[model samples]
Target: MNSTLPHLGFGTFRLEGQTAFDAVSMALNAGYRHIDTAQIYGNEQAVGDAIQASGVARADLFLTTKVWTEHLSRDAFIPSVKASLAKLSTEYVDLLLVHWPLNHNTVTMEDYLSSLKEAQDMGLARHIGVSNFTVAQTEQAVDILGKRVLLTNQFEVHPYLQNSKVVAKCRELDLIVTGYMPFAYGAVLKDPVIVTIAEKHGATAAQVVLAWMRQQGYVTIPSSTRQVNIDSNLKADSLELDATDLADIAALDRGHRVANPDFAPEWD
Candidate 1:
């Protein structure tokens, strides 16, 4: 399994045009080494531009990008990644992912897994994984890959939507859990429980939530546009949470998912 991925990453979802470049540039300046983006997000060019402008050596960065559902077919998979690498201005991404598990009618699990492995074998991605997959699908993935080829699973996880079921399975398979929308799309920031915990820690609600995820051993990719927010989010790694704090945060789980789309698979 790949180990270059940090516990925290800079997400580029919805960040595009000049906004993506600025946020990514600031994120790099704020000391983030891991950057996450996707072909579906239509911002690989901006991410590439930011990396180029940041002057941070490619060797120092852990770049992650996802192959959209449209490109999961064997024919499209490798070409899609090649396109992404060209757009990112990088020869290879540290990690590549199946953005979502869908359209089973078109691409069988075996086919997609084989294609993803083909990408890895071709040296397009140093490591490969999946996003938004449940335990059953991950099992199928493992069986098809026939090894621990997946390095992590990116999913929507937060205090409101704990996702313990998926987290448990990924842990069982020894795949690191990458929690996207760890803030619950900003809905959890002003939550009463989160507020109370933030007060005790003297940290922002974002920091408290991020710290909880970190303490739980789940990697998070929380996005931000402000420099203060980016810097503060990074500090979440240092904000230690105690048992009581953990329990309080745990009590806030209501399965409040914020990123679900109509095409999303049945969630774990």
Candidate 2:
């Protein structure tokens, strides 16, 4: 629950073309200052266009982009970040992250992490961290970076896939945990327990889950193409969950993760 990162952020994972542009523009208009995108998302330009069109001062925005696996090399890291900056239409990203750890040993931790630090030193990135990294990989990143700070370890955290092991490791390392896919790609929206809570609170199941995440003191970025949902997700911050609601949601964890790719590292 670090105040450094906005508690509720707008995610641009699958959004593209006019959808990406429109969604980002709506989010900015709806008061979402934190926007998360990555090179792999292929929507940075659209996101940038929306940011420019919104007329929100650059100083008021918190923009984040990730370095793709292919750009983890010493040679490609800095240049790739510059490309992302150009696409984002910003001189520096508020946060930069290693999107994922390489499945093979093609890029060493030392090389990529040093390159990440170098990017920050060069003023291309204001902060840096990792995503989809396992406990061991997170440890190695901290060791490699030494005194330099890793702001947050962003991975999947939701009612169904709590990912407590990695979350604990991040806590021990002093890295804030940013939970993406907080609704498990809409899978948790139909859960009977969540539904019951939603009815009790007179809120949507999605809002119930997002409020639970906020009560647990974790940052979550839930994306939506609908204007109502974009506005409603941010309103979860105002929804208060009592102890019983918190306990019910905590018991919903079933170790079900939804973001596993072939290249994902071993889970903790």
RMSD of each: 1.3, 1.0
Candidates' TM-scores? 0.98, 0.98
**What tens-digit string does per-residue lDDT give for candidate 1 at 1-268?**
2355798899999998999999999999999999999999999999999999999999999999999999988889999999999999999999999999984578898888889988999899999999999888888888888657899889999999998999999898989999999887799999988899899889999999989988889888999999999999999988998999999889989989898888888877
Off by over 4 Å in 2: none
| RMSD (CA, angstroms), candidate 2 | 1.0
Window of ten residues with lowest summed lDDT in model 1: 1-10
Model 1 TM-score?
Answer: 0.98
- Candidate 2: Cα lDDT at 3: 76
In candidate 1, which residue ranges exceed 4 Å CA deviation?
Answer: 1-3
Note the Cα lDDT for every prediction shown. 0.91, 0.91
